[model samples]
Target: MSSRVLLVGIVRTPRQRWTKAEELEELAELTKTAGGEVVERIIQTRSQPDPATMIGKGKAIEIRELCRRYEIQLVVFEDLLSPTQLRNLEDIIGVRVIDRAAVILDIFALHARTAEAKAQVELAQLEYFKTRLTGLGIEMSRLGGGIGTRGPGETKLEVDRRRIDQRITTLRRELERIEQERQVQRKRRSRLFQIALAGYTNVGKSTLFNRLTAGATVVSDRLFATVDASTRVFKIDKKITALLTDTVGFIRNLPLQLVASFRSTLAEIRDADLILHIADISDPKVEGQIEVVNDTLATIGAGDNPQILVFNKCDKVFDDSLFTRLVARYPSAVFISARTGAGLDILQVRIKEFMEKQMVVKSFTIPAERTELAALVYAGGRIIGERILNGKRQIRIRGFAAELMRIRKEVRKRLL
Candidate 1:
């Protein structure tokens, strides 16, 4: 059975970027994704958050009554709560109290499939728990089992701070080893042009990944449906092949622990030759979502990378004037429906254009008897022009710097 959850938001006089309703709505969706039923939502308008109870003592008491009336199993705050705030809210409300970050962490823990993903989620959980343990000390040790207390939290609840620290150290080492393995794999594909898909959670990046690569990625309506980075090689044209990676989606105010734990995954974006920044054209909050994704890209040091702004799910949009306005506003943006494959040709053309910009022209000759070397050239680059000379095949090629470099190394090795 799903846990009955109550969503709570604090509204300050001077509002932040997202309105109260929008923020709470997103929190509600997050709650549902975590297998919780949002029974009710409460908003407290205050000058500022109360240091002790977050929503102030009076509102906390009111929540106690509401929780009893609704049989609320969980109370989730829209914003992150300090250790003291988390403890105090649970004490006053007489139920488990967690915040937005915890919900996101729990969802990551639940969706984690592969060993690396599991390890990363566990590391993030332990890191979040470590923070909760500090300041509150022994009291936080009493946290019980449920959504926020899954994964490492379930097994390590009774353990002291020292044990948690030890586990954190161990996970970090494991992640470091995984990162080294990734480096080796990256080196193998260093010659290929790399494209990474990055965008807000549930913005159709995974769907587009499947469309572009003909690979299956479990698609869902839930936020953060894709946690692990999945990479595949795709041919842009007869001659141009590149590596495409579908990376974890960004969220507004993503948990710091998650950011630190998933550095290996995000590195794909940082190292990519190009980025496909996908956004859901059907979403009313598309602009805000775009801004959040841009901010996240900047934070991870991929801000200046060449990107094609792609507004996905255009099949759901029926307004032509809206498209005209959007085109005027974002002149370089591409509109496509990843589900129905609409405008995909244009999207591919955009990608091909980006690929061409990074390519260089070169001329080389390989012995006619060495069919394998001729194959290598074809595999690594586009044959702009070619001619057969006496006992040799003279080739003119266009490819990325790395691809041409590999071909040169191969030709030199064979000649020697």
Candidate 2:
């Protein structure tokens, strides 16, 4: 059975850029995604948050009545709640109280399938609880089971701080071993052009990744559907083969703990040759979401990496005028629908153009008898043209500068 949930938010300023209503709506979606049914939303106008109950005592009383009236099992806050706030709210509202970060962590725990992803989620959960565990002994009796009560909450949450620290150390060691394996895999694909899809959650990054790479990564309409990094070979053309990676989606005010825990997985974005920044063009908050993705990329040290702004779900835009305005606003952006394969050809063209910028034309001369040397050049790069000069094969090829240098080194070694 789904847990009945109520959302609470505070409006700090009289005149705000974004109203509390919008934030509460997103919180409601997050609650739904976490398997909770949002029964009601409460928006309070306050100059500052109440240090004790977050929504003040009066609102807390009203919420207590609402919980009784609606049979609400959970009260979700639109902001991060301190240990004091969480405890007081649960006491006043008579239900399990959680903040936005906790809900997101729960969703991650639900979707995590791979061993490394599970480890990362568990690490983040422990780090989150390490601070909140104090004074929650009474509340633990109430949380029989629900969101914010998964991941480490199931088994390790009731333990002491010492045990939590020991578990964190173990997870770190395991993640380090996994990261070393990823490093080896990355080195093996150093010659291929790498592309990573980065965007806000539910913006269809997995859909686009499958469209481009012919992969079967699970795609869903829920937030944080793709928690783990998925990579596949992208065959752009006969000779142009690139590696494409789909990373976990970014959200507004995503928990810092998650970022710290998933650093190894996010390294795919940091080290990509090109970043395809995808956005749901149909969303009303597309502009803000775009800014969030860019800020996240900068936070992860991938700010300076080359990016192509890709506005996806173009087919969902019903207003042609709005579409035209968007086009004029982002002249260099590629508008595409990954579901229908519309404008994908154009996206591939853009990728090929970017790939060509990293390539250089070079020639290698090999003795006719040394067929192995000529084969080495073909293996390393695309052969544009070849001919015979003075009984030696002259091969002209276009490829990455590093690969060309490697082929050159091999030729020199064979001649020596």
Best by TM-score: 2
lDDT tens digits, residue span 1-416, model 1: 99999999887764643598798999999889888999999887788889998898889999999999999988988889998897787777888888899899988887877888888888898888787764332455545456676773224333466788888888899999999999999989888889999999999998999999999989888899899999998888877788999999899899989988999989999999999999999998998999999999998899999999999999999999889888998999999999999999999999999889888988889898888888888876778898888999998888888878888998889889
TM-score of each: 0.94, 0.94
Q: What's the TM for model 1?
A: 0.94
- Deviation in angstroms for 239 in model 1? 1.5
Worst 10 residues of 2 by lDDT: 152-161
Q: Write the residue-wise lDDT of candidate 2 on 249-362 in tens digits.
A: 999999999999999999999999999999999999998899999999999999999999999999898899878888898899999999999999999999999998889999
Worst 10 residues of 1 by lDDT: 152-161
Q: What residue runs in model 1 are displaced by over 4 Å at the alpha carbon?
A: 14-18, 134-144, 152-160, 366-371, 387-393
Whole-model lDDT, model 1: 0.87
Which ranges of candidate 2 are over 4 A from the true structure?
135-139, 142-144, 152-159, 409-416
